[model samples]
Target chain A: MIRFFTNVWNNFKEYIVLVILILASLIILSQNKSPQVQKVRAIAFGSFATFTSIISDMFSVTDLKRENQQLRERNAELMIQISKLRKYGIINEELKDLLGFKDTANVPLIPATIISRSLSMTQNMLTLNAGRKHGVLPGMPVVNDRGFIGIVHSVSEDFSIARTLNNVDLKLTVMDERSRINGIMKWTGEELVIINIPNTFDIKIGDRIVTSGISSIVPLPLPVGIVEEFRPSETSGFSYIKVKPFVDLKPIENVFIIAEVQSKQKKDLELNFYRRQSDEIR
Target chain B: MKFDKIFPFLIFFVGLLVQVTIIPLVSINGIVPDLILIMLVYYSITRGQLYGTVLGAYYGLSVDLITGSLLGSAMLSKTLAGFIAGYFSTETKRDINISTFNFSMIVFLCSMIDTLIFSFFSAFDFNTNFVTVLFEHALLPSLYTGVVSILFIFSPFRRKRLL
Candidate 1:
């Protein structure tokens, strides 16, 4: 017994240093982030959403009568607006031109519902009613009519957890839709703030935020939010900013889970990289 | 040990529900009371250092599982706090009645240490706004837990001999 313990201890220091070195290297290399990880994560998130949807099916506490009434009111308002737009003639012309512009048949949406919310003053997270069986996976982008919320992280058979833009851990590769200036989006725990841009960047309040496509996980040109606040950093290079997320996470009702319509070539490209990385790690 | 088998598990569920649900509703700034620390302190005062250290680890693990932060973060902090509280238990005056004031002081000290350790791990540095975190998260929750201990300390659970 003494000999066994001594032998293990003798080997422990060498193994510990090797493990630490490997971890440090991975951190440095992966900080730029490999898009393949994002895609796999999204798939895992999709699975979680599918599971949550199943569980929610078993029980619901919402007042159906009130929900039906609200839906009817919204539909009536939309109909009235549509009629008004037609009377003006410009709405038809604009919509007709838009319909002629591009094909949207390729990308399909899986519907998911919000199950729970993390509302601590300092931190926030969301659980969705969906998961694996419904094709929800980790790294899948969650959004509502307003804009992008955040990516799916973990998935269980019946439910999945997500971190929103409000979460400090959430980081998205984003750019100014107008100026095309690229930067990363992050949340600082103190407030609903997203900081870290160099002063040289051409960013302005009300400038539309969109996914930069630099990250394979995030689809390009998807609306994120509007820049709400900006201030110069004490050091010369960066400007800190706050964004008003388009979706009101406090009252998230319905969300759309997007299945990225990756071309066969792109799918192979990512899978190849992942396979290589896994092999190297092992 | 039989008490350990049952009471800790019971405390975990009750503490977690109160931690995630009830405490959040009543907090000054969404800062929930630390039920685990309160229970640990109670045990530490009566049980001893070894028991307190073990309970602290269990409490921390439960929080980590529920919150889904980095694993072991809470466990590390909780264990340290439990060990420190154990040292105090040895010196506490046996005749001094456990009063609201006494409970307040014990909880305030233990939770302050808990908050400082948690913050240190989550952030790489202790340089930013220690006063705010210590006051808001640590001090407020400690006071709230202290008030709860006043009621719990006299309950039937305490009537049974700790041994």
Candidate 2:
């Protein structure tokens, strides 16, 4: 027995260490969702992103000219659209004033950069430079020059993680632009899916999908994706639709955190809904 | 352990930095090469089992902290990979080299084990097909890591004995 024990210790010391370390890892995994560990991960990953961004910036300089040209073109297009929208808004306001309609609230945009991305297959998250210090909070919406990206999942003082739109874990209220039909959006592994759309809806390929804006964190009519294909779901009464996101996420560098949010009263109600939904998941 | 042994470990850490920074730019369908796994495999075959496991834990912890993964998934995956690689460890360190097919096989196997465990803990979902993840992520990444390891063997650092 003594010889057996000695031989095992000599031959399998690494496995013993592996077992002990795996146990420690399990403990950490169990607490992975806690706010305390989330904060720690935020701080540590924030610093790591900051450090790596410095290196990425060096390599990215060579592509600056091309990226700058593309941004300039996009900026011009957006500016023209903004001017058109302003004219429409002015006309609408004048009509609303005559009708005694209350003015709508508008929140400011907080611009940020995409620092890095999570390499996990199931968890599609992006690390952004904006954080609590920049008034970025969890559940804040993220967007790029193209369209809606995701919502802030967690935040540190100087950095926050955004759950990308392609992530399977995120369930959002999305609308079909043409038909104005709304559905729940989720990742279907092979593609982004808009779930539970009834077969009766007059939806089509190339129709724009945007945020239904039922939630406070998301502004209404935010562009998300375009419908790609549709198939009958297992649920029997619904159409399982695939959507191709406007933002591919690959080669994405410059993005904005649309810190635009609703009033506290409205936001609190939506937050309660989200909290309940999350609780039900667990 | 000799103080100079720490230098080679620093070289291994560069692999971690590469994994975090450069690999993402070239990721093939979100399956980035596991440079740290390859490093652990190399060191295990060159050194011994006990040394590899401890170093693997450290490297994996660094990855978990940097990537904000499910906290301990990488740590467990990497520690287990190191222990597995240690099985292929040579008795004598003098003959250790990465040129042979044997070295690549060890790296390939170790990397597959690393990815399998990592995706299992961090990415296993009821929605996505497990077979898809196993093919695109675990198997593909292991193959890519093995190819990259072979390339590194011919690099100047290894040739000059700096790694």
Candidate 3:
């Protein structure tokens, strides 16, 4: 019996690490009730993902070449549209003035290369080449030539992580560029969709969607995407709309991070008004 | 312990670099093979359960760092896989090639576990339906990982190094 106990002890030392790891997992699972713990968990996971993405980007040089060729071709097609828009500059200017617009604001776009993409099964995150050095910060909006991509969530010294609109975690205040009906855009996991718009909202397929600038994270009137499909929710009073994301993230290379753009004072004013109203009732 | 201890880490790092670099070029719809799982299986079969468990935990940590999923998520799945795979280690016949068949099964199982854990966490985070998690990302990618393992058996890594 003594020899048997000794043998078990000898073998126990070999698998001790695995036993400890399993125990740690159980502890985390049990202690994850606090929202603060969950936030830390999310941050840790995000950092880990950002690190892996950077390492992977170091090896994506060859793949980036092929992606660059595609982007260049797309860039040429966009230039034609830019030229046509330039031709109608007078009419656009008049329209902008009528709609209460700012003068031609020189919003300097800090462009960066795509460092790494999330191949993970959960969230859709993309790492950008720009970081704190380039004035990129959390909550800053990112875009491509097509439209709104996502918002930066985390920043390292040399890279920033953008949580694409494909992520279900993001909620953007958006409206149909044609109909003026506003809604919140969110990813539905299976498809990019919008919520909070009433069924009677005047939205249609192919109607261009743009940011309402209500959210401090994004500038007003930025292109979001086009409405693809719409249907009334089965169990709700609101309608659901599917949006095909304007930014084709799969072939992403260079993206522009918009900083020093959003008007935070407007957001603060709205928040204060709401708080005051609520306080008066209380 | 010298070669046994150091070899898996070496293979783990190599697998990680290759997974990031080489596998992306070969995937369809950005799904790459699970190279770390294959290495875990390979070593688990050669070494005993204890060795398998240790390497599995080490490999899982590396995978968690490299893949960017939840922190202990890969560790839990991989340690379980290593323990389970190690149970069948001493039973296999020595002369026969276990790489091909063993590699396929491990890829299938580990991919399923990895995907399921990720999707489960995603659903918790995003409030998406469970079905979407299973159908959207899990099914096809796991199949692709399995197919890649079959091809990996024929690659020079298997032939030249006799690994």
Highest TM-score model number: 2
Better of 1 and 2 by lDDT: 2
Docking class of 3: acceptable
- Model 3 over residues A1-282: C-alpha lDDT tens digits? 999978877878546756786787556545545566545544544455454555655655767666774675465336324533533352476787699865433455667666555556346677676777899877888877776788887666666777888776678898776776778888766677787788877888998777774556676356777899989866777887898877776766677776755666867788899999999999
Return the candidate ranking by lDDT, descending. 2, 3, 1
lDDT of 3 at A13: 57
Question: Which of the numbered candidates is closest to the native, going by highest DockQ?
Answer: 2
lDDT by residue (B1-163, candidate 3, tens digit) is: 5975687777776676566545656667656667777777667766767777777777765554444344566667777767765665666542133455666766677667666765565545434666766766677677777776787667776665454
What is the DockQ ranking, best to worst?
Answer: 2, 3, 1
Show where candidate 3 strays beyond 4 Å: A1-19, A26-104, A261-282, B1-3, B48-70, B91-97, B124-132, B156-163
Clashes of 1: 37
Tens digit per residue, CA lDDT, model 2, A1-282: 999999998887777888888898889878878888887778777777777667666666657646774674465346335433543454566786788855333435676766677766656788887789999888878876577788888887888888887666678898776676878888754578887688878889998787874644575456788999987666588887899998788787767675655568777787899999999999
Return the top candidate by lDDT: 2
- Residue B4, model 1, lDDT: 64
Q: Write the per-residue lDDT of candidate 1 for residues A151-263, one digit (tens) a residue.
A: 87666655566677766567778877677777777655454444557776788889877767566667535677788888878765678777776666654556666655334
Instruction: Tell me how each candidate scores on DockQ against the true complex.
Output: 0.16, 0.59, 0.37
- Cα RMSDs of all predictions? 8.7, 5.0, 5.5
Q: How many residue pairs clash in all the candidates, one count each?
A: 37, 0, 0
